[model samples]
Target: MMADDGGCGRCCFSFVLTSGLSALFLWLSLRTYKPSLFIQDLYVPGLNSRNNHTIFFQLTLRNQMKDKGVGYANISLSFLYNSTLLVANHTLPAFYQGHAKTAHRKDSVNAAALPWPPSNGTVSFRVRAATRVRSKIMLWFTKSHALVVAADVEVGASGEKVKKKSIKLKSGVADPGSRWLRMGVANAMLFAVFIF
Candidate 1:
C-alpha cells in the first residue's frame, strides 16, 4: 500500500510539471503585437482651390514581428479638417503581410469642401484609420481583431507635409484583442502557478 501511494504521488507531480510548462509556452505563443504605421507623405494639390482640392497621401505599414505574419482586412481611412470636418475618405482592400514586411499605399481623394488656411500658412488635418487584423502563428490564424489609429498632419503652403520625417500614427484607445491577450497571459500564468 505504501509503495502504491508513492508511485501515484510521483505520477501526479510529473503531470503537474508538464502542465505548467505547456501553459507557459502557450502564453508566450499567444502574444500579439500591433503593426507600425507611418505617414510618409501628405499633399494637398492647390490647397482648397476651386479646380483641385484633392488630397493625396502616402502611407507605410510595417509588420515587425520576427516569427509571425499579419493579415489586414479592409482599412478605412478618413481625413479630417480642423479635426472636426471630414475632408475625404478612402478604403484600402484587404492584404496579407509576412513578417518584417513593409507595404506602401498611395491614394488620392477629392476634398471639395475643404476650407482655406489661416495666417499660420499651415493647414491642420487628422488622418484616422480603422481595420481588423488577424495574427498568423505557425500554422493557424487568430481571430480577427479590431485596430484603430490616427495621426495629426500639418500641410504647409507648398501643399506638402511640413515634416520631412515619417509621422507615426497612434491609437487613441486600446484594441479589444490586445486586452484579451493580456488577460489570456495573466490566466495562463496563474494556471501555471497553481500547477507548480
Candidate 2:
C-alpha cells in the first residue's frame, strides 16, 4: 500500500507540471503574436444620370491575425460631389463612425466586417478595413448638374497606426423628370396591350 501511494503522488506531480508548462507556452505564444488588419476591394456602382437614382459603392476589409483580436475599429468616410465635401462624419448618418471591441470575427480576436463610407475618392486611397470591409454609399440625384464623386477611409489595428488612402469613383444619377417620363410611357404601353 505504501508503494502504491508513492506512485500515485508521482503521477499527480507530473500531471501538474505538464499542465503548468503548457499554460506557460500558450502565454508566450499569445504575447509574441502581432495582429494585422487590411482592406480588400472597394468600388462604386454605375448609375444613369437621367434616372433620379442614388449612387452606391462597396468596400471590403480583412483581418490577418492567427489568433483572435480584442480591440476597437474606427472608420471614417468622406463624400464629395463635384469636388465638394459632403457628409464628413464617420458615424452612421454622419461623418464619424465606430464599433465596439465586442464585435469580433469568426470567434477570433479579429474582425472582418463592412461599414459604409460617406463618400468615395476619385484618385485617393479607398476605405481601409479588416480582411473584409464591404460598405455601401448612396448619392441621391438632386439636380441636372454634372458631378464627380470621391471617397477615402483610414484603418489601423490596436497596436498599429492608422493609414489613409483615397478611392476614386465616378458616377452620376439621371434627372427625376426623365425617369418619370419613361415610366409613364412604359405604363401607357402596358395599358394599351391590356386593352387590346
- Which one is best on lDDT? 1
- Off-target runs (Cα >4 Å) in candidate 2 are 1-47, 50-53, 81-84, 87-196
The TM-score between candidate 1 and the true structure equals 0.83
| Highest TM-score against the true fold, candidate | 1
C-alpha RMSD for every candidate: 2.9, 26.6
lDDT (tens digit, per residue) of candidate 2 on 10-80: 99768766765675565434331112222223222211121222223343222233343322223344433
Q: How far is candidate 2 from the true structure (C-alpha RMSD, Å)?
A: 26.6
Worst 10 residues of 1 by lDDT: 112-121
Give candidate 2's TM-score: 0.26
Per-residue error at 146 for model 1, in Å? 0.8
How much is the lDDT of residue 195 in candidate 2? 43
RMSD of 1: 2.9
lDDT of 2 at 157: 22
